[model samples]
Target: MFFKEVVASLYAWDLLDENVDHALDVLQRETRTNSTYLVALMHDEKRPLTDFYYPHNPRRKVYWTEDSRAYWRPSPDGYERIKPRLSDSDELAGTDWMQVLIDASRARGMSVGAELSHTWIDKERTRTELADCVQRDVYGNPFDGQVCFNNPDVRAYAKALYVDLAANYDIDYVMTCVRGFNPGRGEGADTELGRLVGTTHGGCFCDSCQARAEAHGVDWAALTERLRWLADGYDRFNHKQNFELRLLLASTANITSLLVELPELYAFLKFRADSLTEFFAEVRTAVKDVSPRTDLRLNHYAGHPELMGLDLRSVAKQLDSIRSSDYAEQSGDPARMEWKRGYLHNIRRTVGLDMYFLSAVSPRPKATPELVEQGVRISAECGADALTIGHYDGSWLDCLRAVKSGLDKVGIEIRPDLPMWQRAAPALDGNPPHEIVPSSRS
Candidate 1:
């Protein structure tokens, strides 16, 4: 499938004012992509009033509203335990972007995909109205931006959203993005000690998660002790004078010794992975029950999925596809492509699932048309089953065009006029030329 991440605000900017059909046609013509998906809720805390490039259409105002609210109106029967704050912007008062996309897609005989960022929530409202759904760390401190997935109420809320989408809209895919735990102070977080304690990231150590862990034969008390120790050690390591010398052992002897002394940490990681797999299973079953054809896809953080409680090899069974961004263009680091290739290949080799390589296109100076083209070529070379370009804005026109050039160079053809089901390629069979690397638990 050739997919594009569309910003719904573009519709309010008059992209769809001429009609959804015209808008989708413009998207297809510009990007040569077959299918498009947008986030169910606004995740960006703020958006620029205009893109880095100028708009070709004089009527279209290039901008995104700075609001963390749902782009779609919640169904009266859909939300029960917890509800999302729907956007009440005057510009979007009557427009239901999801319904528009679904209707437009159905008219074109194309499949609709609904994406949900599980951790993206209304922080202000959550702090008061839905405080119970907030996630807590191992230290029992509440954090914003993410809700406790283990919380029965949050679980019910998520399941309901998926089921509702499957039952109400003619959506063929439900994609999810659940982020990893924050490591430490951004600059000094590369140490092994930080990753060792990452299991405590927005950790859902509430009563429910604790009881569930104990029920699954994991010693909750021992795990907590180990986590607290690792966290403390990381803090001390940060303050050490010989931090540079200690870095040599941080990944080798220090982590190895800690792991040997703390076997419960392994159990804790497995338990976290299990919890995520189980959550997806329930969602899969519920969605399938409602619409048997709907498939579940994960927006995987390829860098460290384990930190997010997802060992892809374990959770792969519950998912039909894995979509992750390639960091080559974003980082302007050619070396990142090595890991990008390994991550894509390993997913195919280990998980045996279809992979969608997401490439960023714009935001100038950093992401050039050449860089975007290189990403596309690399993704194809790495045996990615599909391509997903994140985030189409007016300024990304040149970069969007580069995708077609990249596809041509890679010997792939694009039929943007056709539906994805008709034009999407079959899943790849084997990994590219690379040995699989172990996803570190430390």
Candidate 2:
């Protein structure tokens, strides 16, 4: 009985097919979910063609939105203070995608939500206008993706972006999708040994970050020196003979040793976490100040939140809900079953907020139907308030059916919101009645 909602995260391109009403109907019937969160901002560059499951028409080119642009237009009051450095989507500009989704969702009596990726900014525009906002290494070299959370302009822009969404739309919720720092990207080495040896790119030592470090009592100079030494050592190790063998020999002892040798890493990590929690608190207040009814959520994909500087327990207090793919046992390892089982329960009990574990329904190396059902059972068992499937478009019918079956097994019944007449169109010859394919425009 802990489950209060079932939300499907749908891509914008999924609705491009002409049969907007029919698409929503199909989504409801298949996923048996009462709500949806439309991805309106940007897309993943690494998404392959196979990731798209929207059965396309013959004439339509199989393409996805590659730009880091907001799909909807900002209002007059929005972005008046700071520039988010955002660009308009060439393919979907003037389409009013968010409003279109809200209207369609209203017809089906379904709630609508939106998510904004923290790092998905227009790099070209940002490079010109707000270059200091971008994350930087100890050497002050800027990372391509993430903007520094410590930067004042970036923080202001984040608040403005969420406020804009809440003020402009009839949305139910707004989630911040953050991919914090990639602590495992050891400059160019990228290995577990690199992380253990503390050679990873734990950065944002830009002027803002350095100032924040000084204010927070973190010795920025000492931390930077340690990071440089580690980077040099890693480089030297790579050039040495039998480097792979040396890497494999490294262990967690190296982590402990590194922590002992360089204790400033602790303060730096805490500062990173505190910075994010502060950002979330500010954005939460900003959104609530503008539109009190709109709920805020955090969707962070990385595991080991401590390492990534995301203190989930503290951050959870600022969110109405949280969606995490980590600790889901998505890897399907039976040995880690208890870890997955306790994840949601612990968070809910401790933080006293809704927790939504993202259950991916994609192909292999992602998730299968059995795993999806098990994930549902686990979420229900853990007292999670919601379950959000990664996407309706990327998912198959079998996985969606498994969700319903799992829910039924747990005494949860999901009835379609659409009326009988408007429930679903007749299925194709070989497909089931609930199965829906897109209509032609030309």
Candidate 3:
């Protein structure tokens, strides 16, 4: 299989291929790389994602994770899931858009996976933290590593949500859940923490986190003391006003090296490592019980671990390993000046960027020839199987072709481990227009 050979896969290509046929058309047009796999998503109240017409459409089945909160809303069409709510349907809504995509993508020969939306907590079940992994809610209220492992209610809930979809709807993989996103910047806070007008977003101070840590063999009180130590005299640093420009200068390596090597810190802040492992195992086992041949992958951002109380590398090693999302704006696009700098070289996912793509960064000049090459080559050398050049609502220009050409030469040839390779060390383009936020790891 194409996926078994390639170390990675890029989920989207050119933003074309609405469904199966469109994808097949691309495969027919190209020489077709054997090392890549396509990840197909389902769309509801929209076009069928099938008609996948490529040689390397999607090797796996399907599942869908969409933005749940309006703050995360990509655009007008983002809120289709659980929308219009449910009526007389015996099993929730009739095969959600996720099911549609999974069914169609499989028909087109793609691997489907779901990172279910945020709002859909098992209707009859209570949202409780399991004695497990660390995933926090919008309020920074930590969630016990998901309940799929030890809690039968959770396991059964997940099974019901997905199993029916797989058989009745024809999907292949379900990503279980999107790691709970802790909206530290106060997307919905009535208090000072919510305002985040200019304060540190010391994330997740919840009771469940304390309990989950205990279940996972953590010394909770000791960990709390360590956190206090880490935050000593730091309440003065306002997340807004007191933010320092120099923190941006701190190298990602300086910040990343810490979390990659230390699992204890993950346990201390996040609850427990074993619980996460068992949680992922449960997801896989549960999916397998229904679709024995399907692949399961848990979602986690490449560089967000340490900053967000997550251990991404550990999660990567724990799950099946597929790179998720990377959003950035390039100098070629006019909007490039709008976004601050966000790079992904330091991530170990650089080693397994299976099924991924680039999104946002539009307005032409923003998708600069320089930025495109840098981003794509970074993806390839880091072992990305395929790459997606993204644009919102069809705003892409020729930057993709320009970057692709350069990639044929110096792009994938560099080694990620070497310092020289990371930058080739370019100087600032003089008086950059935007003041991008520096690494959160600092």
Candidate 4:
């Protein structure tokens, strides 16, 4: 079965002979995979793929620091400082790895796309030692890093960097790697393990943001606090509880505020949304600038209300296409798969990112054909365009089987493209790289 376009989340930063050979073995063994793309979602200081991949490399680790050089986003100063650097120490086997993958796919009679990492702004970096990278809601609640896109500096820097990356790596498809701004889990966020609570991902309330809020005739801090309140409340409460408080967070909470304090929130959010709109526009243009033939794809990362501020439909009316992911993890329980539809539905409406459910990180090398059948049918209920079996670089028998079984059920072919990269194995505690750094709680 040939997929429209299959891809792999290549975590090959530490690819060794054994790993590469292992991936090659899988590449040799699996069948029906067509035109597998590479997921360059990497952001170690030594691994700045964006210099040759995406514009404005915000080297954002999952809830980590912004991944870019002298990058900028929204802050009271009107810009977040993100210095960019180049990682050109080592060379992979291919002359132009991205293009090589494209050529390889074409040789296999398949079209290819690259979900290259556009990750530049890491959400979780200690802005100041002992200072949390993110902030709490205005009223002091759940903390989530707000990806501030309004800063012209970040846009300028990202555009400049993207131009270089796209110019260098010409693949068939180009999509920015949307990442999590919040991490360490929220109080009531859904997790494979249990309840999650932390103040992560919310961003600065600087003078510039205040100015923007005032310009919009609003109290910037108040509005920001309101948004954080929503995130915190959601973190503190389960999905249902968050739903109950949404009205309060969005509007009712503002009812009692002094009119002077009211406009800032609206102003700040409006500025944020408009700024992102501008960035995306620039991203589309930059990609076109680099490789006119390349198609563009963007992500809505869960429900980004800020991005939705100006109506994502209107904001991104000009881009080629946008994509979203369910990013599902493998599970023993069928209900986990079934239960995910709710998450996707809300993301679709909230961000209006026109997303199609993409289930990845499945317990591959372990999934049964029956399990694949059930998951495939259930995931498709959300109007998924296609299914790609996520194959990590460890004990991947189940992932290979998942590809075959799910494709068989969906009447698609297995795309046997080479592993563009390798990723770490799923952690039992959902915490790989304990050496990366400890959470504030730790």
Q: lDDT scores for all predictions?
A: 0.60, 0.62, 0.36, 0.43
- lDDT winner between candidates 1 and 2: 2
Residues 1-442, candidate 4: write the lDDT tens digits: 2323444543333232234334433544552444355544334343222122221113332222224322111122222354333333343322344444555556656555655353554434424421232333344333332333444555554555445445655455556653322332333434311111122223335444455445544545455555454445555455654664554444443333522343433343345454445556666666675577665555444443332333355343434544444434445455666556666555445434343223333434334445655655555555444454444333235545565566567675433352212211121232111122111110
- Residue 302: error of model 2 in Å? 1.1
Residue-wise lDDT of candidate 2 within 1-442, one digit each (tens)?
5455667766566666535676667666765777787776774453323444344332254555555667666665666445543334455656877888888888778888888865656777557666777888766778766778878887777888899899989998888676675463543445544554443365667898788667655667777776555554445454542363355436444556655555665556667777777777777778877887787877756545565667777776667666655434335565555666655555556555333333323322345677777777777776555666765554556766777777777776543342211111111232111111111111
Among these predictions, the greatest lDDT belongs to 2
Instruction: Determine the backbone clash count of candidate 4.
Output: 63
Please estimate how well model 3 matches the true structure, expressed as its whole-model Cα lDDT: 0.36
Comparing 1 with 3 on lDDT, the higher-scoring candidate is 1
Instruction: Give the lDDT of residue 332 in candidate 3.
Output: 45
Residue 267 accuracy (lDDT) in model 1: 68
* Residue-by-residue lDDT tens digits, candidate 3, 1-442: 0112111222332122245345333432331211222232211211112222222224322323221211111122322222212322232223244444444445645544444433333222224333222334323444433222224444444445444444444443444334333434433435432222111234444455455445545565654554443333234463532233124223243334443443333444343333344444455555556665554444444333433334455444334434435545333443532232333444443423442322222213345565655555455545443343332212233553444354555533322222211111122233211221111221
What's the true lDDT of residue 317 in model 4?
43
Worst 10 residues of 3 by lDDT: 418-427
TM-score of 1: 0.80
Give the TM-scores of the predictions, in the order they appear: 0.80, 0.80, 0.50, 0.59
Lowest lDDT sum, 10 consecutive residues, model 2, at 433-442
lDDT of candidate 1 over 32-137, digit per residue (tens): 6566665675565323323453344444443455345666667877777677667666776667788887777777655568787645467786688777777676
